[model samples]
Every structure is written in C-alpha cells, then in structure tokens.
Target: MSQSLMVAFDVPDKKAALKLAEELGGGQGKTAKVGMELYYKEGAAVVQDLQEQGFAIFLDLKLFDIPNTVQKAMLQLARLGVDFVTVHAMGGKKMLQAAKRGLEQGALESGLPAPKLLAVTELTSISEAILKDEQNCRLNLKEQVEQLALLAKAAGCDGVVCSALEVADLHQVVGDDFFYLVPGIRMANDQVGDQVRVATPAKAKAWGASAIVVGRPINQSTDVKTAYQAYLADWQGSEQEK
Candidate 1:
C-alpha cells in the first residue's frame, strides 16, 4: 500500500478548502482531512465532492458525545463513505464500541466500506502541564496515551490519533498492525503554532507513525506542491532508510 500523507484541510471557507483539495488531488498524496471548521460550514457535500475528484477523506471531528448521539452521528458519517473518522477515546470504551457499531450498520445500509474508526488519544496542542495540572491526569503523557490507545483497541477501534512523540511506544503496545494517524507535523523551519508535541515528517515516519496529519506547514506554504514534495521526500526517504 502507498503510505498515507493526510493533509489537513483546516481552512475556514469552503472555496479555499475546495481549491486546496483540487491542487493536492493532482499530487501524490491521495488522502485529505476535513475537520469541523470546513465540515460545519460546507457539510457532507464537500466530502462527496472531494471523493468524486478521487481523494479519500478523513473526517476529523474528534467526536465526543453520549453513545446514542455518537452512534447516530457516525451512521451519517459512515454513509458519506469517508476513509476514516475519529472519536475521542476519552469518552471510554462503551462510546468507542458504540461508534464502531454505528459505522458497521451505516456501511451495511449504504453498501460502502466501513470507514476506519480512529480514537483521539490526546490532542497535540495539549502540553504536559495542562495534562497534569489542569486535567488532573496523574500518569505521565506517554503512559496516559498508551493506556488510552490500548483501551481504544480493546474497544474495537481500528486506530488511534496520537502525537508522534507517542507513536513508537504505542506500536509496542498495540503491535504494528494498529494504525497511528499522527498530527502536529511541522517542517524543520515551520512555526509550531499552537502545537506542543510536534515532529518532522522524517522523524514521525522513523518513529512508526502509520500516517501523519500535517496542517500549517503545507496549508501556509507559498508553494503547496513543493512543500508537499518536501514532506513526501522526508517520509519516503525515512522509510527507505528504515
């Protein structure tokens, strides 16, 4: 399988999002992420449009709700035929299971392949202090992330979204088959913005990230195709080195 380099279509407007999607659609990366910002603005029609253009979508809503609500929502999302979607693992095993059940039912009804359900282990923007002090999490970040990832896997999730910082250890716990859709990717000189646990594409690839979700580095670049090429080169070179 070709390695996934999921670009985050984190723009606020539908036009800009569509334009970016069009540009990347002609590039090597075949997958793109649609988060709440654009989805709420443009709805599932945007996803359908992108899919028609031959790009797989990762709906990154990071859903966190009661089982019934999440299940209902996942049903709708699954019917859209997205390649992946995310739920908050912090919602506990029952919620994750509920999400899986919904995906299965929706895909069955729609005659589409069930989207891979990924659990959000932790957000990349959150720092150690926020986790320990504000969130009252006692375990260190790595330990907590591992615990969540195992919980997600046990709950029948196909994967988890973790920081590159936790990818290697997560692989040890979940084994190599579990997908790690890592975010918080930045080029060496790119600004980190709000992210706290950022890693370069080469580092993320070397550390065992199954795929990396890159945002600002590509989105903010003057030449998006070149930036994407650089990231692809980084990951491809890292894989070759491995």
Candidate 2:
C-alpha cells in the first residue's frame, strides 16, 4: 500500500464509530483503526461490519502476554482477516515470534492473508523522563525504541507502531522494507492532548513514515469530512508544490 492515513475510531461504541466512518464515505478503500475501546465493546462483529463496508481494519489490541497465550490470542485475531494488528514489543522475542506463527497458521486455515503484525515500540504518551524514571531503563528514549524495533524485526514482525518523531532515525536503523506506522499525529495548531511526542502529517510524510493514525483532530471536529480532507492534504502534499 502507498503511504496512507488511518482514521482512528476512538469512540465508546459501535454506533458512534460507524457514524464517523460513514461520514468519511463508508470506507471504500480507506482504512479504519479499531483500538481497545471500540473493539472491547463491540467485538469481532464490528470488524466484520467495517470490512463489509470496504474498510481495511487495523485491529490495535496491543496484545502482551506469555508466548503461548499471545500465540493463542493471535490465532483468533488472524481469523478476523484484519489488514493490521499490534503486539507489544516489550513482550520479548519469544512472544513476538509466537504471535507471528499464530497469524501465519490461522490465516492459512481461514484462507486469508495474515494481517501485518506491527510491534508497538514506545507509546507516544511516554516522554524521555518517563522512560528513565517510570520504566527504569538504561537506554535513552530513541535508543530504547530502536532496540525494541530491532527485536521486533528479528522476531519476524512486518512493521512497528511508533511515534513520527522517531521515524527518521528508525528508517536509518531498521531500513525501508519495514513498515513504520506512526500514531500521535497533530496538526501545527492542534492541541497535544495526552500525547507527548507528536508531529503534523506533513512532517510524518517528510520523515518517511509508511502510514499514520489520526484521531481527535478529525473525530472531534464539527465538520469531520473537512477535517479529514485537511489532514489528507497535508499528508499527501499539494501537486503544485510537488
């Protein structure tokens, strides 16, 4: 897929989520992210609903568990036929490997292509201070993210969910073949909210991000389509400028 924008469905229920999706043209080659909130409330039926509406789903459960348990969980997720899924890179190499294996096996059985397994590096919510103080880690924030990304790639993941702030360095370290799906995107004038590390869609594109996940800036707007189009414009850049 070309560099893309994935609208995050961060609402409380399926009705709200679907409404937002419909306002954005009911998918039709677009992608939607069903994160913890919506997924936990509505379950797999919502994913199927989105698929039927022609939305490619990114099921961001961020699974983290022992290798066997994670593998079992991934097996079930693979059967959903989502375009992407996430697991915590902090889960270690064994768990990441097991998760990939489960997806492969489950997709084969379901006669579907396995979702791209994206390992979550450090959350955009985590600041450098939090990394040193709360996580009690030796590595600095960038170093830690880079380390986890290497671990994920070694374990057979197709990509990683990371901050756009780290994309340039990660591209250097992890290479272009690995997908860098960034989240925590905010426009220049947008509020930072809970995310500490954030960037505009234009910066993300310039830094070579494979894709971006956007939420409140579009979702909370009074005019959702206009907000989405603005983001897409920044992300894709103007043809005249290009």
- Each prediction's whole-model lDDT (CA): 0.87, 0.92
lDDT of 1 by residue, 64-152 (tens): 99999999999988999999999999999999999999999999999999999999998998888999998999898999999999999
- Angstrom error of the Cα, residue 225, model 2: value is 0.6
**Backbone clash pairs in model 1 (N, Cα, C under 3 Å; residues 3+ apart or in different chains), count:** 0
lDDT of 2 by residue, 191-214 (tens): 999999999989998998999999
The pairs that clash in candidate 2 are none
Clashes of each: 0, 0
Using lDDT as the measure, the top candidate is 2
Using Cα atoms with residue i matched to residue i, what is each candidate's TM-score against the true structure? 0.95, 0.97
Residue 101 lDDT in candidate 1: 95
